[model samples]
Target: MADPIDPSGLGRLLSETMSALGQFGGGPQDDVVPPEGVGEAADGMVRAAVAPPGRVTALALDPRVMRMASESLAEEITRAVNGALADLQEKAAGAVPGQVDLGGLGDQLRRIQEDAGRQLTKFTDSLIEAQDRLARQGGK
Candidate 1:
């Protein structure tokens, strides 16, 4: 039989994703204004987007505790993305979606989270690039 998935795996994903985001984001002290902040926020958002949930399964946290942390982290990521969007919209007068529109974004995020298998594509591409560079060096 296939390995059982923890019922709380999604929660774990959220928590671990948040933890990774926190590291990527630094802290309030790291914040800058306008475009730089937007760039940093977008990077954080993509890191979460690109994170694979299977890794969450491998974490050693207590399932019950991690589940709660996951919920909070998911909320934090949503807020962080929306907050960045809002700030950028104010500065750029562009069409950043409102926080209320996060439902649509969240739907996309859920799909990404569920289809974590595709993460291997990134690794495969990276390996190919490394091999190409080595070939260019004539096996140096």
Candidate 2:
């Protein structure tokens, strides 16, 4: 026989499900203060720092880099920025969960719906049975 559904247990399941879903949005990650990512190019003559959401927070060029030709200077700057963005991405990935089991969550929800449907059917059957019994007794 299937276990009887307990309202408290159903409530707890819903609470847990909501909590798990919340993690994907703004749970633990909200508290994490992501560290800035810094990168250097051309022997550290060009430096760049990036923050969360791929925003470049700072760029610095060593006085020595000024002597380089315009094209080389631009290349070094681009390299520094790209490196900083990459570093930021790597760090951010580390700070967050690697994967979310949305399929699992969907399966869980489907099970819950099935259970509710079964319970409703059982209740309806019981009500009908009771009504029939009462009608028979009244006719006597």
Candidate 3:
């Protein structure tokens, strides 16, 4: 026998689907920028702050660092930039959902689809049975 249609279950599934999709849509967080990631090198003589999309928002050099040889200064700068980029990458990774989250969402959607299909099939079967009963009564 087919399962009975459940309006409450269907409503709950639709709500869940909307909630999941809302995570990927624009919201209050859309207007807010993530905090910049700061990194330092050479005993804090060089510092860099990186923003999202790996943009360098700021770079600072201690006065003492200016006296270093050009090659050494460049190396310090490279180290600071790399550290800043690494920090930014870590933060961004934490902010985004991983593969497991996406996979779970896919599974949820599939279950909703299956549930809806089952409900529709049940409703159709019920309607057909009622029509058949009505036809037999009219033929008598």
Candidate 4:
């Protein structure tokens, strides 16, 4: 006997298909302005703000950090700036409107499409074999 087809699975795929269709209804859109990302280092002695377009908009260096050598200060500044820019990338990825999260929805869609294709191919092969069997029996 064949395995039963789950209606819920089909329903979920249909829902996802509809969602994708609706999301793509409009043409290309403008980029959304992302929120600023701020990061601190050296126990908050150095703080950096990464504004939109990934530019460092502001920097706050505490007077305490001023006593450090130039090389050490440069390293601390690099650390703080890197942290802020990393945060900016994360916020920008999540801030886009109607963007499908590849982590979840994209995986589900890929699985569903693969399963559907396999099932369709299986169905077609079975039909062909059945037709061949019928033809053979009729000839006999």
Among all candidates shown, the one with the greatest lDDT: 3
lDDT of 4 by residue, 51-126 (tens): 8788999899999999999999999999999999988888877765575455665666687798777666666676
Segments of candidate 1 deviating more than 4 angstroms: 1-68, 94-140
> Candidate 3 lDDT, tens digit per residue, 1-140?
55666768768868877876665553346676796788899999999999987889999999999899999999999999999999888888777654446777678788878877777787899888889989999999
Candidate of highest TM-score: 2
Positional deviation of 107 in candidate 4, in angstroms? 22
lDDT of 1 by residue, 1-140 (tens): 22444445556667656654444444344554333223112224322111111121111223343345566655655555455455544554442223343565466556657644444444456677778889999966
Tens-digit lDDT track for model 2 on 42-108?
A: 9999999999788899999999999999999999999999999988888877867667788876777
Ranking by lDDT: 3, 2, 4, 1
Ranking by TM-score: 2, 3, 4, 1
- Of candidate 3, the 10-residue stretch with the lowest lDDT total is 20-29
Query: Residue 10 of model 2: what lDDT?
Result: 54
**Candidate 4: where are CA atoms >4 Å away?**
1-33, 98-140
Candidate with more favorable, higher lDDT: 1 or 4: 4
Q: On a 0 to 100 scale, what is the lDDT of residue 8 in model 2?
A: 69
- Candidate 3 vs candidate 4: the lDDT winner is 3
